[model samples]
Target chain A: MKAALGVMALAAALVLIGKAERPETGWSFRLPPGFPRPRVPADNPMSSAKVELGRRLFYDVRLSGNGTQSCASCHVQSRAFTDGLANAVGSTGEIHRRSSMSLTNIGYASHLTWANPLVDGLEAQALAPMFGDAPTELGLESAAQLEARLAGDKTLQGLAQEAFGAGGLTLDRVLKALAAFERTLISGRSPYDRYVGGEVSALSPEAQRGLELFFSERTECFHCHGGFNFTDAFGHEGAEPERKFHNNGLYDLGAGAYPKRDQGLIEHSGRPEDMGRFKAPTLRNIDVTAPYMHDGSLATLDAVIRHYEAGGRGGEANPRRDRFIRGFILTDEERSDLIAFLESLTDPEFLADPRFGAP
Target chain B: MRSLLLSLALTALPACRQDTSAASLSTHRLRFIATLDGAAANCKSLAAPPFRLRDARLFVSELRVIGPDGETPAAFVPDSRFQSVEVALLDFEDATEGCEGDSAEHTELVFEAPVSSVRAVTFTVGIPFALNHQNPALARAPLTAGAMHWGWRGGYKFVRIEAQRDGVEGRIHLGSTGCEGALHAITSCAHPNRGTVHLELDPATQQVALDLGAFFGSDKGGDKTDCMGEPADPSCHAGYRAIGAAGKEAARQSDSLAANTTNPAMGASAFTVIRRTP
Candidate 1:
């Protein structure tokens, strides 16, 4: 009996040790330089089968209630996953309140949506576009409906079996697969990245000057839109989650109110002081993800720069505006240099990569 | 491990026996019906030919039975997918006619209160701020229903009533607006937007009439405006007033016109106790 108990104790210890270390096999991430491994939820572990299945589902229109749209409808690949619309038009032709955000390095986002701080997980965030009815993106009503639509497809079923370990197609499985695939969308091969990697000739002289201006105290561009992912709201394995929203002084109807239709973080926070505050989206693919701002109000990089230089459209009167957005005069040459720097951050290879493309 | 198991077993005993403490509490079922011009309206009755009821679902919270002794909070039983101890979703659409989704019609609020002569009923017409702004993906029961989840707002729609007339659709989607903070740790809401409702109940049948006509307003056949609780939208004035959201900033938004004209305090008149004939 003592020997049997000793064997059981050893087995338990081995299991605990195995779990404490990094996963040895099954699915491993080919993370880029200066990038930490993303924090994957234990419930939905990383798997190659799940990623493949999610790639298929991400582009499948049958996942929608009307069979007219899918996740890809608004999140196009070449455009850094943004539809390039001022407002994202839903599958049912309903216009969304906010612009479609870029999915570039979305796995690193601490909070999922443009403003909702509680939507910290990609699995939970997937439900918004899939089943959300306010401006119905995918417009799917129920999981039963989704299951019924994909039930006949043998390819999805086989993939689901391999991905989920013998379970038939499920909504939970679908979400996990999508999140798994999204975690693999790492873009760290831009000119800026190359420059930081010690390649002196990666960026032009003008772009290097622009980079200095961006990080300078005058522009203060690097405060919210800083760090590896270029957005303060970044998280990873064992990293502290930063859920930050800022008011770039987009509008002030009377007080610090934004457009009534979409008032940024204030709509979620419900605080008077939080008016017009919105998450600073990553500048990773900002060149491709325009017109800028929450509403896509800025038409081009030049306009966005000018808006920032002028201390936002609301002017200095806006009390709730982020202090970093204080006005600064930028010469025409300096302006183009900054734009060059922003453009250099765009990874052309990542955009055209078939891995993220439709199957 | 044996001592730990014994302590856990000791803790579990009270939870299992806790149900017995509520044995004296009597179950009270309140029937709520949608009415148009004082007539009971359903999806079957209000098809596409006339004014079609697209959807009508409201969250009733903080329900209490006002008796002679005092007010006692109604302990809502986990009877259906439409109810929970924290809040109850009173759905009026059966997903027929003009209704959009697969929503089962549920228009009852059943709760357990002490056995006493109930004098009146009081409840809020929306969800509490705490329960309203959480992640709906992780919500349970009636909160799990997809049709009521307002993702962009980071909260559940407190009240959703949609109707179509003469090819024009009118909507009243109410939720907490100008809210501050993250989802789980929301600090405050500028406009709670909840309507306070109180009514004297009949001793026999506790039936309440949800006057849809009042919600749509007396104006019929003309252009009916929608209100998503935007302060700038003047269309929200009548609907907010009828729901008795009056003095709250939720309704005070359209009251920008109040500077010029005198407007009476809005009372919660959308719901009223009906005396049923035997």
Candidate 2:
């Protein structure tokens, strides 16, 4: 009897994922210097075991209803976790309205999605791509079908049992585990990150000058793209998540309006003032993530800089055009400097990390 | 050791809710039967454009049987996973005989309730703001069905109906909007975007007639068949009225979910309630 109890204890100590059991110190975070710890949900606490299991599920195509795509399908790590598509095409080849955003520093996003104000939890957000019907991503018709598919996979079934205790492969547990893995995606190893860490020699003099121009009143880029993660929409525990949405004069249909189908925040709020407003994504990997904006309308960083310089682009004087987006003039040298500064934010180690790669 | 692992599996799994409503005497069953034009409607008939409804699902909550003073109390199932104070999620798409992209069929939302102090019934047309943000996959009964989950930030579509008219596809997705806060909690919303439906019902009746004929009919003035939750949009007028909005312009608002206290002359629409019958 004593031997059986000892065996059970040993099994519990070394969870099925072959990782350390819940240690006395709990989940140890390896966040880079100067970054605060991210706040995780009470229900879905971060666990190394959960993260390990999630990595396997992330690469497995079987997670999709059609067994053709996974989370990694759209969020490729080499391109800073963005699929490098103008707009995301789903497992069934359905075209999504918006381009895939980088998941580099997703943990710090105060709000999830481009325009949605409601989806604040990563667990809840996972359901959209996995089950949403219209623009199908990882399409599963129903929960029962999902359960049956997971139950059939012997290896996954075993890992899920260890991660969620008795609740093997539930949609709740899957989402929680996926979120736990996503929270660990910290990227502060770029040259800019090193420069910010008291190593002024890390950035080229051109990049250093570009950094100055980025924050200068003339450029005014920092108004929306300020902070360690480089977006106004960032927060952690106790810090009230900065809720902001802006319409950078992206469009004007006759009377200060965006296209009817893709009206950004206005579609959710019904307030005309919110028309054409969208969430400002993290600039951590701006260089690699091409064809930018909520709809991927802007093709290059140079083009983006030019757009800001031109101001409204004669879009019928949109009523809700962001005050900060009012056009600024810049010389050719200044444009290159700004682009260099944005490029300095990339963390090469994060882009090529084998751990984030497929198992 | 093997037995211990099995026990863990049993505890974590959502316990199968066997109709076991037969276990007690005081408990009575509740069901939401759907019909259209006074008959079992055909959701698939791509005759023209808007006339063909490829699929449809509606989420109903906060069911209350009115009494002399206000809402009366009843013996709610304590073990039920989704049983809020006095709320339930009624699904109509579970009956997937003629639907597209769906396999599991739920004919009606059937549950157990203590049939006492019941008179008129009142419910909401969309998901309440408080319960709208939580992980729907973790919840039970209707929430577990999985078809209702829409976009993550968008949450569940309170009323989602899809159809193709003149080869032009139209869909209506209704739910709370302009809400803020984390997924676990929402601090506030500029527009909660939910409408309440009140019906003068008798206690003897067990089912409410859910007719969708008027909901599918074409509104000549409206631009599209869908009401995508925009305030003052031309599309929401017909839908806002059909679900119980009496006022033309003010009844169905895409911009504000706040009740119009200033305009007392305009009456609220009570469209979801077709009739109360046994």
Candidate 3:
């Protein structure tokens, strides 16, 4: 019995020694050329173990209260993290008012979701889908319920232990892990990116013309959907977070109103000037994450171009429309060229990357 | 852990009241109750035809007690979950039947005030501007409650009165509207939506009564839909009128609370003060 106890003690010491030798590797981003390091919260630093655990949780259906769906259900990786639906459907079959936003370079966004200005951090934003009841996404009733579900699974608990160092699985830890993984969904390898990287043949002549139109003052597409991430609502390590919302004049119920249910920034601010203001989503992977607009009212890229060309549904009569959204005439050839340029923004390699996929 | 903290708070209350120094600070407890036309009502027994209460909660702040001399600021005693120095949350729903958030039932506002005969009281039914737009994930209790949060708009509902009448659900969520600015640098909210209530109460008043009938009443030809506190929402007229915070130009554009529908000639208060028998 004494020999058996001695052997057990020896085994414990060996395990401790093995753990001490196998140090955790520090995480570093293989950022695309010209891309800056994404801004991370001071509380949640990046780690390989945490990101791996987050990837597993991101695809785990048990995260939902009913265990019917996961984050991947609405944010499918192949479709640039959007479900390609007009409105997102929750785990319990409740239809959401807004569409699923693409996760492509979401870490760079100064704000999260379609319109909320306050939700800037990914950790804070993760709480909405997991426990938000206004058309519940993950449909979790409470944090205790989520904790119980996560603690019940041995594999998940082991992963949590690795990521968070023997601390029990918790909501804050889960959110941090999920956010760490989401930050790694960097997409900057499109044909447009290649063209910018000195690859002259990366873009066709038609796409090149479309790109010019997109950047030109006539279309003014680059005004909002500009910069490396193709959006004005961008932030990085040393940059002051940009908060820009515009009214594209999608609808005019009466007196420059866009649907009563969703009046964009006005719904939050209650200011008359903010009637139809909405964030211009990153144009990266915009070709796949359709239907377009805040409410997903527009069907295709052609329809979007037409809406912009016509100066929105209300035309010049829309009092709340952005100054940049003035009427512009685009030829059929120019329109098709613009669509081709948007398609060029799609990064096939990033879409098919196994690193961002379910573990 | 929650119940233990609550018991600690309850235990601390009696000790505070035991202080007998002349003209010194003493704890004043004001219990709140929901009523269907002056009759006590809750999630379990709301009304006939079965009115299912989903959520009923409101934030009360800037509390002051009216004395013979003047108004005295009644500072809320900081509690573990619901009461803070600046604000107090009165949650009625018990997470039974249709109720879907925190099961903790909080319906009292305990505050420290100078010992005096309280004849009336005044307070605002809304979240303070400073704490309104803060990140809820990092917020302390009462503010951290998910059901009370208006996530899409980035604020807490100042007043949430939700129920189903004959299987048809109608919800009234009142919060600041036209709120502009980033999380930290909030410029301003166009419609602050903070309802100011001044009630005349007897010294024996034990409960602050909220009339659900007045809240659910529709002045616009019985169009009882969900009111998300949007100025464009015609459905909000009834709620705003009931809360005595409605303005003629509110639906269009006006930030004047003086132009509210609460007329002096009506002689009606936003909330009625009553004494509930133990």
lDDT of 2 by residue, B76-132 (tens): 243243343334455445334335555343434332332333456655666655556
Off by over 4 Å in 1: A1-24, A147-169, A252-257, A317-320, B1-30, B43-52, B61-88, B108-140, B153-155, B164-169, B175-206, B216-267, B275-278
Clashing pairs in 3: A268-B179, A269-B177, A269-B178, A269-B179, A270-B178
| TM-score, first chain, each model | 0.93, 0.91, 0.92
* lDDT by residue (tens digit), candidate 3, B1-278: 43343334434554334223423556777777888757788877863344677778888886777655455666778887788777888988887767766578888788766646676787777777778777665677667636677666667888888887766777888877766665433556667677767787754556778877666664432345688886467767666666556653244333323332212222223478788556
Query: Runs in model 2 with CA error above 4 Å?
Result: A1-27, A197-201, A237-239, A315-318, B1-39, B43-50, B61-98, B108-133, B150-155, B187-213, B220-223, B245-278
Error of 2 at B243 (Å): 2.2
Question: What C-alpha lDDT, on a 0 to 100 scale, does residue B84 get in candidate 3?
Answer: 78
Q: Could you tell me which residue pairs clash in candidate 1?
A: A269-B179, A269-B180, A269-B181, A270-B178, A270-B179, A270-B180, A271-B179, A271-B180
Over A62-96, each residue of candidate 1 has an lDDT whose tens digit, in order, gives 87888999899999999999989999999889998
Native-interface RMSD of candidate 1? 3.2
Tens digit per residue, CA lDDT, model 1, B1-278: 32343334334444223233432466777888898878999887888645888888888886767665555566567654778776888989888878886657778787766545567887877776657766564567667636677665556777788888767888877776655455434556556666778788844575888887666666564476676665345666556666667666533432111221222335776888786534
For model 1, the local distance difference test gives 0.75
DockQ metric for all predictions: 0.28, 0.41, 0.31
DockQ of candidate 2 relative to the true structure: 0.41
Docking class of 1: acceptable
